[model samples]
Target chain A: MTTYFNEMYDSGKVRPPYARLEDWTRSMPAELREMKQAEAEALFRRIGITFAVYGEGGDPDRLIPFDMFPRVFTSGEWARLERGIKQRARALNAFLVDVYGRGEIVRAGRIPGRLVYRNAAYEKAVVGFVPSKGVYSHVVGIDLVRTGADEFFVLEDNCRTPSGVSYMLENREIMMRMFPDLFRGNRIEPVDSYPEKLRRTLASVAPTKCERDPTIVILTPGHFNSAYYEHSFLADLMGVELVEGADLFVEGEYVFMRTTEGPKRVDVIYRRVDDDYIDPLCFRPDSMLGIPGLMDVYRSGGVSICSAPGAGVADDKAVYTYVPEMIRFYLGEEPLLKNVPTWQCSKTDDCKYVLENLHELVVKEVHGSGGYGMLVGPKSTKAEIEAYRARVEADPGNYIAQPTLALSTTPTFVDEGIAPRHVDLRPYCLVGERVELVPGGLTRVALTEGSLVVNSSQGGGVKDTWVLAE
Target chain B: MILTVDHVTLYRYDRPVRGLVQSHRLMPSTCTGQRVLNWAVTVTDGLAGGAFRDGAGDWIQGWSVPGPVSEVAVTVRGTVETTDQAGVLRGHRELTPPDCYLQSTPSTRSDLALAELAATVAGHDDVLDAAHRLSGLVSEAIVYTPGATAATTTASEALALGKGVCQDHSHALLAVARQAGLPARYVSGYLLVEGDGAAEGQEAAHAWAEIWVRGLGWVGFDPANRCCPDDRYIRLGSGLDAQDAAPIRGTARGTGFEKLDVTVAVQAVQQ
Candidate 1:
């Protein structure tokens, strides 16, 4: 296959934005070059840029693989992507509100309720509860992959507790030193404003009579979580207290945080914990990460929590199919973005088609994340396809299928030299009074040869996304 | 006079496990003509210590203590009543034609405020007039849809969209009352129903509002049923809102989702 870098460089479509990087790569001495990889790995360990591999009884932490070469987007290309992301987020938010509140599209018989509600993330607890600003999934990270220079398709939506924005921020810090020349001359937009935007969104929902300077807190499950670095990073950036569940309480319809002085009123909480772990009273009674009466405090208008509980109902894969219709129904505006064609197994006709086309399409479990219970069409064994077919037939609502397009690839520096690897972009958005996109996002690369899965859990690596100036 | 009340709640998951539980109790006492309020709470969950936040942005750390059983329970009972209202007798009067004291009439600020809340306005012309306006507005604004909201829904969110569940209705009324400068609090207790009920399910632990009235004292309002809390109402606890008076509040040690089922039964006796 023609390498992405060679094609772009040879065609002169755009002079390599980081032409100076070529010198940085070539100038290193042979012995020093071999040692650079080891030095990079050591730095990653020292900085604690690692992920917890769940279910690994011992030695759970593994260093996140970082690519030496960064993927760059020109100012023109980034502008289009920015707009596309905003459009996609707005549409998805509308879809969540509609599905939970009115079911207009479901009543119209376009999407099936059985498919939407059956997903584990779909919360019956939030059916009629509207958020303060009429917004759900305020922070969205839409994963998109490119097949060619300008062609892109959305892979999935990560609206519920999306991790890795921290990775994006941390990756940039590391990249600046590793490839200083490439970053300095490229004019990449800075992603440092994300924490500030996040803080503002949480504060926007404070109760009416709260103190003028409302105390904001970031609620986390503590240091054991895989995304603990992101939690601490965000807390530091926002200049707010990082609180565990035990550090908070609900009294007289108000939420208070245990501080050095005493119980202080907490106006807004940017809760990083999942819904089931947020309030033991409302969700899992066994959850020690949640406050007993926290949900009641929120209900009573004594406090505000970001993204709100039960917002996950819309991000269910089945709900993704109805988003375009929801955007039109709620906003009266056409969706500027398009979704990858999906086959809903709940529909008999679609399921029939999917079963017949199993060899050419990707099959995914509606509720699974982190690349679990997924089948890559072209790579699947015949027996595996037959087993998946049986699973789909037994519980049609649990599955969805789509054509496996060749996800776009970028030139990544490998041991053998630069090679083509599938990559995807997940830009983070902070929706307060308006939507704010962090300049750069997490660009995930499928590290294995010809592998399409780019989830970090699936042996994927990451590159720093550069939104460059024109 | 001062009095203290204690509240206790229990929860059991499908699985067996010990957990942490937190609660706030309001206890009331009377001496001469004054009433005093006292509160106390205990939280026990996890190996890590627990803490509580007060109105002043302070933390009161909780020590780790061993608990018994897989099912978790939290209890909060406190007492609070106006000191000046102590020993005051409230006599019951029958209606020849019961005058509506709760109704907001002439569309005055008081009337508007009354109408804005979800309360009974059947007797007092003033409150009745306002009740008509508020109920009409709510009915028009919110389209009845199941699974749109829960008991914890906020008022502003619901009103912005002009729709919500029972909790949203109560919250909207509460917000309007607070905006109108009325000292109002959320009340969670039980509603006594006669015989069998509708198919929507049995009346569970219900929520309403209690607004402080100058002469009448704290009066009950049922926004969900658009009536004054009457014979069917069994008052539990009063707080700034629902969070303060939740029947059950606690924490557990699991990492997955939990299913909760609540049942409330209230029986009325006549002498």
Candidate 2:
């Protein structure tokens, strides 16, 4: 019988940011709204914005269900969020440098040495090497969820090539074209400059090997990857070439891309391929998706890799708990954003508490994503809880438990008129010479009733998020 | 003692590949007991890519050959002065923590055979004693036999078979030492083995295990020789296993089978 806060309504009054949307929802007819939804689907299909899900039947290109209604955020709320995100981004980059250089944080006794030194994500090859511009995660996506107007918690940190900005930009593009009237009186912030800003951010971190303007290219694992659309989309928008491994080669410590004119030296690569598959000579030798001798050129400072290799160590779920301490230890300031209270099952006491209270807590794998390999406690049956408890007991370090919060909801046009669906926000923050972010981000909603998981891989949909100007 | 080394490795392909990329770890040791004098690593028909000194105190260089070529030769010629410190390696510029070496790789993962070998040192009072004891156990368990195992064989497989080359000996030592809670790694290097009846005779190349001692830093032990690495040993590099610490790792484009032919000569100079 727990109550969830409605973003549009409180005490029978419409929220200020959502006041205009409330009247629009009441005035619009059901048939017209349904027609608009179909039109939105057609636009998205024509644009070829489909996410390929692995191991699925029929077609792999499943359209990420897009909702017609837009989620609204006020200027004041976004301003605070922007500041917090920048602070978090700065702290994340500083942690990466410190861990790879002097081991200051581990020596200070703030974090356990075993957790970092023994982590699978910790790359020993890049030890004692500082990347160009001292930035590790040039782009970070902080997935956040809200419980109330003043209560927000960061659910996850995507530090390594977070892949949803293209969707964020496309959502706004379709929204503006579909409903020009909605933006007439509402001074909404524009996010169309994200591609240009991203290009600038990448160019600022070019390696010292660059003589003239740095030649930047987006390295993709190829069309078979699930995020191929985002890779080609961003490359096209940024006016950069989308290349595979065969298109590039290493010659005398520098990378060169093959062209009809001739071989051109590439100074910067915003690669979407994983670290294990980025270099065949240094990493997995059998990998076909990686360029040979790429790591050697990278380590010698001939080229720059955006969101540098080994950046995933910070995004690990176990490392996520120490971010507040990182903010304090590195930035010398308190965290503006909040973290969800997490019970690390690695600790004996926490494991015991999680075992005893299995039915009320949400359990997630330390390295799992896309709504896979997790247990949402309240909705799970007793048999399911017992089965999950055994897994937690077997390997406590691999699991973390959290108390399920009543996630906030927004009204949506469903088959039976306006209904509420759970929602979460993922704001992409760009870090480079300057830490900045586009005002709004990708807002994902769970289409199932009373479902809190909003991952696109699951039965979730995306909505256009709008931030009003002051 | 000053040791002079002239090593050459050739990778011959049945058909010429489109491209040949290589990363070479054929640099001389720069530790306290060893000092390099006029060391040079050259490649035939290959463009020098990039070079950097790794945290493990080894200089790695990259090379790529634009081909339709048949053979690639990697030549290493160096002179290194060494002193016997009872297997204690000093002045190595390694930045990784000792505990990080405790992490087991697929090639060094301990199975029941390795577990049994590790159990011989159970209830041993001292860690250094246990490390030496485990090394001695691995040497006794697996005799030096040429071609009994492949280069990629796991330590457990070698122990079960009870006979292997120096590569298997190093892997077995790594597996048992890690099981006994001692941080250990595989060391790829060259040893001065003169005369006939050499161990495995893998073209004068040798592999050993280095374990972290409490009071001492890192100490190298050659289980194949049943002794510690002396002034005759020249440490090239170290990693979690044989493949990771390979002196030469590379990939060639196009479909072609590769045949490796290597010859190494390590001689002591009267200095």
Candidate 3:
């Protein structure tokens, strides 16, 4: 009776798009599969692609699990997803622009004014100034989950610096290296052009002060950061310099990277540093990882910050409820993808219902990321649920609850052959001169037998998502 | 009444520091009672960045001076013509709603002392009357002492000690006002005290608290001076706390023993 919608199959019959993958999976032996898994791990380690696990006592840099099995999608399915992602990104950027200036959406009574104005994520510093090209979130990573063959829902909107594109690119690289024949036979679209596209996107949003070809640099919080590897990798791939806070300085209405050849004017900074630590003068004064006058220059239009400060408000979980309204309000189009039915604990009725059915609903902190502050209802025990309920009751406004979504499963290669595991996709939609995205995105697999959490920090693995060419 | 101000702040370090970046909120308030005749804020050897009028309706400008320069002088000179309207500020263009100020900051967080202070003026029905009562009560509670409290002192700390400066007065007022269900903020501006009074040497640039009245919008109250702001007060900027509304916020690169010398002269100009 426990039927999970597997992307590759429909009642034991192989879907047309996944037939090739099925044949390949059957042809490979158990020993070869084991060897390939080790090979993938070795490749990942050698390439130095690792994520930092915070608050853990052990090694900080843990390699995200890599599965040899790739999740495939037909061109038709991909085309719809591409449209949805682009639509969502455009709407999100527009929302950021509006919230910072005038807040027409708030005035229109579509979204509650308190949500946009009162949210802690809403940075008051960046208000009233629009960035170059009016683009707020230049790079949008939209997290999507599938329920059925045609049912996809947006799980979250990461308008700020969304990491893990390196995994996407790296997964494909290893896949192509390991199974050269599978790629040659299958007309799969290449995702290798992402870095070039990212570079172009950053270049397109250069500030007005640039007299020459704009200098674009990646602003990293330094090597100790969890996504430092991704930062360096992306910078290398884009042919741009990866800079720390100390490596850059703001001078005379512009940001400059300190080079041996004196200071070079930096027009665009693809900053990986969070909003609070981007500028010490404007935000947290004690932040060591921030340029002193970076925000001053940015507000003055000397340099453009990709995914501008305060764009986080648009992606805040409380604001996520209005994304569909945003799409309609700004784009004048119906939302391409549906959002999961979420109950904001800020609402008294929603909070009451969540308390009544604590074990049946998954509750998450509104501002939490990386899957740290969450309670998966079904998987939790009585003691855990009781503790979480008390916490939620203590501060209901900080939490949001949703039904345990029957997340679609994919045939993933585990130790005991192939088994269905939950998966999610984070498509990096680039917004600059125009909204653009690579065909396929990073597909995170839960790896565990019945786990629904696909976050890499939570024992989840990544797989190559193949979008078949027409 | 036209008041001319000369504010010169010098920072001298024991060792050569790297550099300094500063944002100044020195522009005169745009309310009806106060009009700027002339104003200029300059830094020695500093490169001018971009200038912007912030959401709080304050003119802010950025400046940066390069490294290895030991001494930096930030000089602010201005002349403003002020017409007294009984401390009523009119024609200011702040976009933020009053409710935003209700959100208490770390420095203005209310405690047992603040709750008791708010209780002193609890019976007043009108918010404006209650705000005035709260302001007067704060002045009575915390005796004005020049060096009694540090800049990091919160309202509760000052209330417990029973003595503080203008910054502490503003913090205490903000905490108590918020506790009394009135939206309040810390305001930084130049208060022109005519003649050689106690506010002569280097303390003309003052801090106050503004409470949002239901019918009257934002009304300034200076608990340190035991009076609401009049034409003599040239409001520059306001925020949830004193630090956010700092007239000059900066980050000096490099570390050393920094000796700061400040001189602010606010004299009434007879024109």
Candidate 4:
């Protein structure tokens, strides 16, 4: 395996734009290093950075592991990535609109309705409601991995409350102090404007009847959610209240949030809760994280929710295969970014091919994320592969197979020294009246050796993403 | 033909709780073709809560907890409905239709408009076609942004902003259907899917809508997916909109936030 640092720096493929990186590394005293590490841990705890482990008993709070080194991207590289993400989000949104609004694609036989309907994320509740700007996925996080210089592949799509943007901001703050000289020497673009951009995007969705300054709030599932810290952090940075389900109510054709002064009219809500749990009356009747009758208010145009519910139908892994076609069909533009090679199990030919190549392909459950329900063919035992094969045979419609490519690696801090770790980047895009891409993104690293899972739910860690100025 | 429905749910918490209590009342009905087969109630107060049902026939399930009780008690009631067609079952409630009152109001809520829309679309070829058109339009129109709107979102508001949750979708369709003079109602049900194992945060209780047609009487339509209800759908209850047949409805004591997770599964049994 190639050593990421050696290949990037010593081999001259890429260099740390920070001129003082070497100097800072040499000058770092043992005591200072220890203090910095201690400080990093403290910052995470102070910020309450955490991710929920599904079955892990007791406290669901697990600090998101952070690395001191921030990944750097030049202005040119960032520009390409920005355009690519925008184009991808636009296309995906368009695809959702077409799939749910019109059966044109399905009629044209490019995709199948059975596959779309079978997708676990598809909601039958949101049939005819149109959003303010004709945008379904307001906040989109597209995970990308670099295979080589100027070569990146789509890893995954997080259209529903994609998190870790706050971590990107917080990580940068800690890294700046840890490597002040390096940061000062580098031309890293400031990611501090993200909260402002996000606020603007959310504010743009405020109801028309509201005053010039619409009351906006961040609806969270509360402190137990793994991304609770990010939710509170973003709400604080954006100057909005962080509200849980009980904090809001709907009545008299308007959506009101329970505040210190009783029910206050809220014009916009930046919610981090999943669609199913957003409104008890509409999606999940038993969900306590949602406000009853809230959906009625949204449908009445009394308020606007960011990244509207049921948008997941578009981001469904089964529907992901037709994104490029959707972009061309809706926007009349070619996709700026390319999707990873994916095979739909619903298709007879695809299923046959996937079944035949079970031992060589990576199989993923259609509705799964956070690296769950995935089988790494090359790394699996014969028994595991056989079980997966049986599962696929039993329910071919629930799985998708893809060839396992050598995911690109980056230099990650380890006990011995900086070693190569597979990494992926998820940059968030905000779409309200317009699309805004944050300068930096969440850089997830596969901490385990030879492991492709970079989700925090797995044993993955993260680093700050730095988009450098030209 | 006799129709039976069973909804089983299991809820697990991160930590064990001290106490738990749950209660639910069924919708008062006087339909002749429907008969209660078997009713069972169970609650696990410590760490996990589970409820199960076994029997036959078309049934609508509803739950209501009176107060903020922690221990989960789920009541499973089965209703057998006799149908003229073989292997084709139907369940109907002819009380004061909830949508009638909502439609009577000259309000501009999205539910009214959506009901009106559903009614308008119901005149189309089939339930599948109408559902497809409605779902497609809603999906195209509404941007999926969380916290944008809540359950009480009005038809005018959702139509104006074009955003909302399943309640909004159901209400909007109900409004549109009412406007078009169609007897459309809301449905609460469990969608059976693969990947919903015990471990992986793999469970969700789902809601949709249903329209009563001439020949078909009442048929299921999912505007969210733009399709007619099929095998994957497990019907629980139907009402004017989300409020009437809410799966779990009741008041609670705690003032702060209350977290809830519901997992439902319906498996086809071999005779």
DockQ of each: 0.06, 0.77, 0.66, 0.03
Which candidate, 1 or 2, would have the higher DockQ against the true structure?
A: 2
Give candidate 4 regions above 4 Å deviation.
A1-7, A10-23, A26-32, B1-271
lDDT of 3 by residue, A1-470 (tens): 34678998888899989999888988999998999889889988899888877776587767888988889899999999999999999999999888888889998999997788778778888878888889999889999999899999999999999999999999999999999999988999999999999998989998877767989999999888889999999999999999999999877787889999999989999999999998878888889998988888888789989879999999899899889999999999999999989999999999999999988888999999889889998899999999999999999999998888888888898777898899999999999998899999999999888898998888899999999999
Q: What docking grade does candidate 4 earn?
A: incorrect
Question: Per-residue alpha-carbon lDDT of model 2 for A1-470, expressed as tens digits?
Answer: 98898888887788999988988878889888988899999999999999976545557778999987888889999998899889999999999999888889999999888878788888878887788889999999999998999888999899998988888999999988988898896889999999999999999999877767999999999998889999999999999999998899988889999999999999999999999899877777678888888888988989999879889989988899999999999999999999889999999999999999989999999988888889999989999988998899899999998889889999876788888899999999998788889999999999888999998887789999999998
DockQ of 2: 0.77
Task: Give a tens-digit lDDT track for model 1, residues A25-78.
Answer: 677665665575577778778877788867555565787788866777778777
Sliding window of 10 residues with minimal summed lDDT for model 3 chain A:
A52-61
lDDT for position A175 in model 2: 84
Q: Between prediction 2 and prediction 3, which has the larger DockQ?
A: 2
Q: Per-model i-RMS in Å?
A: 15.0, 1.0, 1.3, 15.0
TM-score of 4: 0.66
**Model 2 global lDDT (CA atoms, 0 to 1):** 0.88
What lDDT tens digits, residue by residue, belong to model 2 across residues B31-146?
Answer: 88888887988888889988898766678889998888888898999898888878998878778877778888888999987988888888887888888889899989998888
| Tens-digit lDDT track of model 4 for B154-203 | 65676668776555566666666555555566767644434523233322
Off by over 4 Å in 3: B116-125, B194-202
lDDT of each: 0.64, 0.88, 0.88, 0.65
| Candidate number of the best DockQ | 2
State TM-scores per candidate: 0.66, 0.98, 0.97, 0.66
